[model samples]
Target: MSGTFVGMPAFPEAARGAVHNATLRANLRHATTTIRRKRAVAVAELSDWAELREAGKQIKDHTLRHLDRYLEQLEDAVTAAGGTVHWAADADEANRIVTGLVKATGETEVVKVKSMATQEIGLNEALEAAGIRAYETDLAELIVQLGDDRPSHILVPAIHRNRGEIRDIFRAEMTRWGRPAPDDLTDTPAELAEAARLHLREKFLRTKVGISGANFMVAETGTLVVVESEGNGRMCLTLPETLISVVGIEKTVPTWRDLEVFLQTLPRSSTAERMNPYTSMWTGTTDGDGPRAFHLVLLDNGRTDTLADAVGRQALRCIRCSACLNVCPVYERAGGHAYGSVYPGPIGAILSPQLRGTDSDIDASLPYASTLCGACYEVCPVAIDIPEVLVHLRERVAQGGQVTRAGTKVVLKPARGHAAERAAMRATRWALTHPGAVRAGQRLAARTRRFHPSRLPGPGKAWTATRDLPAVPPESFGDWWKRTNGGTRDERGGSR
Candidate 1:
């Protein structure tokens, strides 16, 4: 959806380079493995984890079903509390609203909390285009910004980078952004964190405007919540005179009671902790307490279109915990950049295509990025059936793109690969429907089994490249059944 990631190739082509980068694979493997292991242990500590997970799912589903009523209720609550609310229908609108608001403040710079919504809408780039500088305050986000790179992971954006690389980024680029790294900065975790802390401190204190996205927005009181391990979000939320939050409309919960479910499940699923180190929540504004002015921009950005599909709508239930990414086999190897969106891994595989439409090469290929191992589903805190959604999206892609824009079906010509697959399925359907043809085909395959190649020829080669073709049997099951059962048939004309 953001032009920042424009011109990305399809998953197959994009992933090819990532797979060859040994260092990137190592970094992803180590980080994800550590996180997933700790998450498993943390989850095991809870006796009612399954119940909590289900409760969170139910809350999101119920809220989504009655989204319009709750959004209006939230807007009224926010307005009543002295905060202004703005509705953004798409990325451009959201960016424009935020940029205009920032420009109105008469400030040349703003500080940002780690926000996927902002990244999705390309808010930083928009601000830069308007000659406003936006500083990233989160530890990981700081590294990404200083290195002049795009975020790969959702929770930990720079998961593709190791300690040494981060140390290098800090030493080389921190001077240009704000403070410079120590002359002898080491790659140890503590040292890197301290370096980032020092680098972001000046931005936090001086920046008049703060921008953020929320983990959950309470509709009952119009409160927005941001939970994080580091204290940067707290600094950004509290210190700035003017604050603006760009949140997905789907992040809203009907009441504080519904918010309880996510408060428990999200931290454990994401950071593998019983609770985050800091959770910053605010409602409207108060004199001498936090920001003087609060602006809540509710972003739709194709979420309404995504909600139209019953099978695909479950993706809206995600809290962006990123638990699925940690456990995904495809994500472990190919890394997040291959997905080509601010959102990545298993969730991105389904979410990006729906949000952006399958018109682009990157969005079109995301559904095929997963191996359907179901690890992501098992680890999901809100019980999103990622595999089911992947299959549904694959069907949409195969049938010439089923996403709609402005009440019209937006169809792209099927990929050349899919066309071949459609032909194969058609041939398969015809043969399966005709018993005579099936019998003849099976006999033919048995006779030719010895001459069969281990690797396929033409388009089929891609499938067989990393996998073995199963050996054709010496005889068909029908012939064997007939021979073993004395050519007997039951009343139903089945083998006895």
Candidate 2:
């Protein structure tokens, strides 16, 4: 529930506990089912939905290909607009930069807009360690913060909690963070919203430093955009005296024209809305308008390494829409916590391993998390081939380790476990490639079919425990075909 993902087990192990919890399963089933149904209706409204989806994908791909040029352009534009840009190579560097910025402001508390980039770097935990209090203003995020829980979904962090649970959390935990919930508060939507609003209002007015993550950063205008259904993002962006936005480098697009494609796709894909209720945009700072000081920390955080992979680089195209999560059978039952990262579901399966590497149990296990149903790929706004990437990462996991390309040099890091799986795959590859060996092996197996065991031995025993091992035929297909002369005759070469 804490910001840190340390010590979490692999997906299968973590999911085991979640799958058994009846309350958790009920919560996930209801939430994901509702969201996916509504998203379908919203998407159906657009006649050119397919075109828009393709446009968004093309825009993201183009930007990623020329990310350096656009990023440099963005820096020049932001600096020209009275904003300072800082580049962070990883999470530690990003946290240090953000912490230093807050410390320099001489403030101990900061209000936060729901920013995945900040969460990814564990900025809240990092700031807490530095004695700085970071408050989450988004209602769902507020629920997560007050409940001391990690986000299960990208858009709706509190999706795992029902209304009754939320009411209880508000009553029990609200006072510790700020204003107490009304003693007679009911388990109604309005009351819960009001309670969160009142509690967060105090922090919004008092806090001078605000931290955020943008949905999109326009390279041409040096503008950062945050789109949300609630008005909390607007409050965090404007009310605070100094605003520090920690954004991923891949969030950049070449121009506002390019931004337009996502503007249409992101809202519908994420919140199922035609347009977000509040679309906040800021070009650095306006002396009389918004924050006095604006700092942009562009975070790499293994993104550059992920970019080194041709298939894996598509993850950077993510706009943080939870569309894939809603449609994913694996995520619905297992929940986001099973993935053990800020990003969860289908995207997490491929993205986490690449960003964090497959050395850990969780990362290695993430690739095998899905059924490879391709529901995720179908819903993705950017059309990222999530299933394709999942297969690619699985290959990496089973083939020893990651193959990272740094310019002309390729670096390989040995990963733990998967030895048996690797051996099996290698043997399979060899057997499949050698026609004579395959034919001979099939003939030998067919000859000894009567003596074959009903179950496999060793590690494969568990696989065949619940399911029957297929019965081998008395004769191999080749021999049958040859004997029948391609099935034209029974025992003679002549046609019957």
Candidate 3:
């Protein structure tokens, strides 16, 4: 709501408080369980859902590989059809282009459809700095706007808040933005929505400019698509006389057919519906149809760099469905703000460090936020293997070297936390490779099993501080198996 994401703490520090908040945990449990169940039902309806998911993954991969070509074609098609196209390399450039466009229209305010790209680039704050107000029309975004908070989930930005908190936000903050909530505002869903609708209605009508971000952009037709449960997206896309969209390059697909695949998958995966309640599709400006003038600012903002890594590139396939977030153990407990970026949860863990680089403690800590749980991969509609990317990024962090940022290369100064982990891992590797020493150590441990302390007393103390060490096995599994089977088991079943 403050339109800023500056000076946020790293993921570990931020997640500390979230893990202890019982109320936040309750809200997360209810929302994630409900969404996950509905998603399972919606997905079951499509018998070839796995195939569709694979298709989506391959299509995104192919598009990203040829991103430059498709982007050029998209720009050509949009410009030929009466829309102006601008290329922005980073958030600052994107914000500059959008603010300049709004200023050229001579409007002091603009209505907005929920767009993560816009949020990632901090467009609202940029507009406000330049004397233009951007009003969030989506119900969830409106709640975030009024509450002066950051969105924790991609699809459901205000998933962390419940009905009661929303009513309070409306009652307390609506007047400052536009229309005021009734004095007797209650926590009922209808009352909350009505308050928001009345509050945003006037802003939509009065604003001459509409700022939006697209879910997918079609290269073959230069068409952009935005899907939302609320009709506010349609209102903002249509009611304004002038429109501007800042879209990330990753949103593009090859053709209408490709768009169709995601349209089905995205809505069901994200909102648990057969189709979105309101789907807005527009090409370059249409005469007397939608906005009379149109401008699209194509944003890279570190996306190209992310596209370069083969293993990590799958993250670019994400359609912002947030299904991964609904099933993520870390996200459910830590909430969204801990991610320290607009993108949060599993997708954020992998995507943020790539986009922002691991130079900062927050970005570096993000990749390690999870318990290496694979739930995120199971729920991802686009088939993004989140756990794989998390491990890959972890390696990048541990290897200790330089990394490219934007276009400039910078040395990745190793963090003290990472250095310690690397040293411990090296020590483990050494011990495991020396079987003679390992066997002796196991025998020693078995001999002292009864006297083994409940907690570790060295550097391992930090790890054992909050946990009880598992009782050492009476004998190592290998020793027990060998003795029982007379060393003739063959290990064909494979060692654990």
Best by lDDT: 1
Which candidate model has the greater lDDT, 1 or 3?
1
Sort order, lDDT high to low:
1, 2, 3
Clashes of 2: 0
Runs of candidate 1 with Cα error greater than 4 angstroms are 1-3, 406-414, 483-496
Between 1 and 3, whose TM-score is larger? 1
lDDT value for model 2: 0.89
Compared with the true structure, all predictions reach lDDT values of 0.91, 0.89, 0.88
What TM-score, computed on C-alpha atoms, does each candidate reach?
A: 0.95, 0.94, 0.92
Can you write out model 2's per-residue Cα lDDT over 161-253, one digit (the tens) per residue? Answer: 999999999999998987999999999999999888888888888899999999999999999999987788999899889999999999999
What are the C-alpha RMSDs, in order, of all predicted structures?
Answer: 3.1, 2.2, 3.9
Pairs clashing within candidate 3: none
Between prediction 2 and prediction 3, the one with superior lDDT is 2
Q: What tens-digit string does per-residue lDDT give for candidate 3 at 1-496?
A: 4545577778988888998999888999999999999999999999989988988998998999899999998999899889999999999999999998889988898999999998888988888889988888888898888888888889888999998888888888999987899999899999888888888888887889998999999998999898888789998899999989889999999988997689778988998999988888999999989899999999999887787677887889989999999999889899998999999999999999999888788888888999887998987888999999999888888775555678666776666776667788898999999988888899999999889999988788888999989988878877867765755545564433
